[model samples]
Target chain A: MEKKKTTIILFSGDYDKAMAAYIIANGAAAYDHEVTIFHTFWGLNALRKDENIEVKKGFMEKMFAKMMPRGADKMGLSKMHFAGMGPKMIKDVMKKHNAVPLPQLIEMAQEQDIKLVACTMTMDLLGLKEVELLDNIEYAGVAAYLADAEDGNVNLFI
Target chain B: MEKKKTTIILFSGDYDKAMAAYIIANGAAAYDHEVTIFHTFWGLNALRKDENIEVKKGFMEKMFAKMMPRGADKMGLSKMHFAGMGPKMIKDVMKKHNAVPLPQLIEMAQEQDIKLVACTMTMDLLGLKEVELLDNIEYAGVAAYLADAEDGNVNLFI
Candidate 1:
């Protein structure tokens, strides 16, 4: 079967886009197509091991401040969004829906063989050390995204 | 007066991002700032009057598909990552998080004077009609995004 080559470039870290990017990548995987997701800027947070990220208060806030993992305890989706409710509400929803949090989502992506790439330039500019990123994450540049996009992968700046 | 400019782009139909966009825009509005959202690709579905989405089946499948809108009823969210229960669980979590659904988020965006722009190129390529889009949605080109983005206002893609 001729598979559709697709690449989703996520330039965001917001929850909705993060979810959309994941869902789209999953759809591609389900279709048995080659898929790659390039995360940059706010998008880089998607590849982090952390969940329950707290958005910065405002301008001048450090990049990936809350998004970055504080440690294994705070890393890897330890906190799912309560959608603004307390942690208890977030947990309740998890129990009710049986939805896999971000960490699980990343695991599922890896298990499904979906490729995850991070933007090296953005990471460097933001002063992120590779060690600070998730273990499974791949680092690349615009050339990499272009290379994939040129392969007829659907390029999206999410 | 130097008005605060906030332009958030929505690229998927996921409830969380839509809700964030809504909340951020509303937040800006509350501060009397100008807010706008440019919707494209899957994000267009959020504005569709008839965006009736459905969840994918299977534990892995459902978890992966959780970020997508099953329909208008499931649009916008105050929560994220149902913690692996499923869509229903995700929704329950969303409710706990105080996340608004997509439709209500759209309504909120408008009520707060947030401009809604749809990417014309994407709509045509996707075979969508104006009717499929929500009312008051403006049709724009890449130039529009560039214009907005170049202005140095808060321009975010999703």
Candidate 2:
């Protein structure tokens, strides 16, 4: 029997949004589906390593790196961002509810062997070096994404 | 041969996000795919009528209605929303490029026979009434969305 395919385009940088993407990806993986999460634009922040990697970059790239969150744990909430308080509040609630944090959710996705692909085009635009991201993830462009999505049972742009 | 299906869960209320959703939906429709855009959460704002409707509502519902944009044209941008200036700049650029605005894209989707569905669960939660939305759209719940999406070639959450 053919396995069902799920492809998600993670395009938002918000912590809550990334959590949603990872949660969905993990769920699909648990269901024995082949899942691919293609991180693009601000979504690339989720894949960034917490420690900065010193690399040569253009002025715009440096500016973007400084402005964007270092990793998933540093990202903010999509709604009620209340001067960075919303993320803290949500994290507390998640802890109380025994909900998995975004970072752990991402780890679980990787453990499940759900393929993670970073958008190479956006990486160049944002000045993110390959060494700056988490290890073991593939890097590709839109053509690769479209090839996966065109036959996917669940193709989501999140 | 069975027609290819595309289903989108329009989850963001941002003007640019909604525009992206509509553009993809329109493109799928043009490609002769059966398409559905299931509006939920903030996505409901795009389906709202610009004119105010005097509907009875609880305090929370009224507050939600008041805070959300009345229609697609009034929604803010997801990125670079510099004190509401980003949307204006985008509109200017879109005008210069002769790009269709979000409202027209919705109209075009209708003309192409694409299905526009409002998530009834979220609509009730948000206290939006039927009269407050555009005519000729269907109201449904998650089951209906999943029914379409489980067989969909492209299922997006935007």
**Which structure among the candidates has the greatest lDDT?**
2
For every model in order, the fraction of real contacts preserved is 0.09, 0.49
Best by DockQ: 2
lDDT by residue (tens digit), candidate 1, A58-136: 4423544544544222322212243533234333344455644555666677888888898999876665556656777
Q: Could you tell me the lDDT of residue B65 within candidate 1?
A: 35
lDDT of 1 by residue, B66-90 (tens): 4434445555444444563454676
- Model 1 misplacement above 4 A: A51-83, A86-94, B1-158
DockQ of each two-chain model: 0.07, 0.25
TM-score of chain A of each: 0.72, 0.98
Return the lDDT, model 1, position B146.
Answer: 42
Leading candidate by TM-score: 2
CAPRI-style class, candidate 2: acceptable
Q: Candidate 1 deviates by what RMSD?
A: 14.4
TM-score of decoy 1 = 0.45
